[model samples]
Target: MVNIALGASLSTVILTVPVMEAISLYTGQPFIMAMTSVQTVMVTITLIVAAINLNDGQTNAIEGMTHFVLFATFVMLTVLGL
Candidate 1:
């Protein structure tokens, strides 16, 4: 409810961190993020872009396009399986 009170829309994405940690513990396999993968690279870039773009509490077409391009590239890489 803190997110609701704060009017923050980022809670959904933030919640996944703990949920994933709990899932890893429950499964006992311990999820590990491979640092040398395409997804990792995309995720890192996305986070950096998001931090820079969203830092001022506003968004624009350029910011949206950046994310779309990153997603498209990630999808293309996934389809090629490399």
Candidate 2:
């Protein structure tokens, strides 16, 4: 599962960025290939938290709750930030 997640993320970055940039350029729009500081920090924190939680390669109620809380935080941040 972890390998699949990593592969999908890697492929998305490898494949999407260039295609997005090309389309942006073709459309005469600036391709802002960057995330906001909040987004970057949040993503970094999420990855760190996920790594810590998944280190034992097991999931439980606590893990699920933590993930749900994190996801809720993400949605709130996105909605409120905009």
| TM-score for predicted model 2 compared with the true structure | 0.61
Local error of candidate 1 at 18, Å?
2.3
The estimated TM-scores of all candidates read 0.65, 0.61
Model 1 per-residue lDDT tens digits across residues 1-82: 8669555545555786678878999989777755448788788988899899999999999999999999999888888886
lDDT at residue 41 of model 1 (Cα atoms): 79
The alpha-carbon RMSD values of the candidates against the true structure, listed in the order shown, are 5.1, 4.5
**Superposed Cα deviation of residue 63, candidate 2 (Å):** 0.8
Tell me the spans in candidate 1 whose CA falls farther than 4 Å from its real position.
1-17, 26-28, 32-36
Give the top-scoring candidate (lDDT): 2
Candidate 2 lDDT over 20-82, as tens digits, reads: 988998999998847778877778888888999999998899887988888888888888983
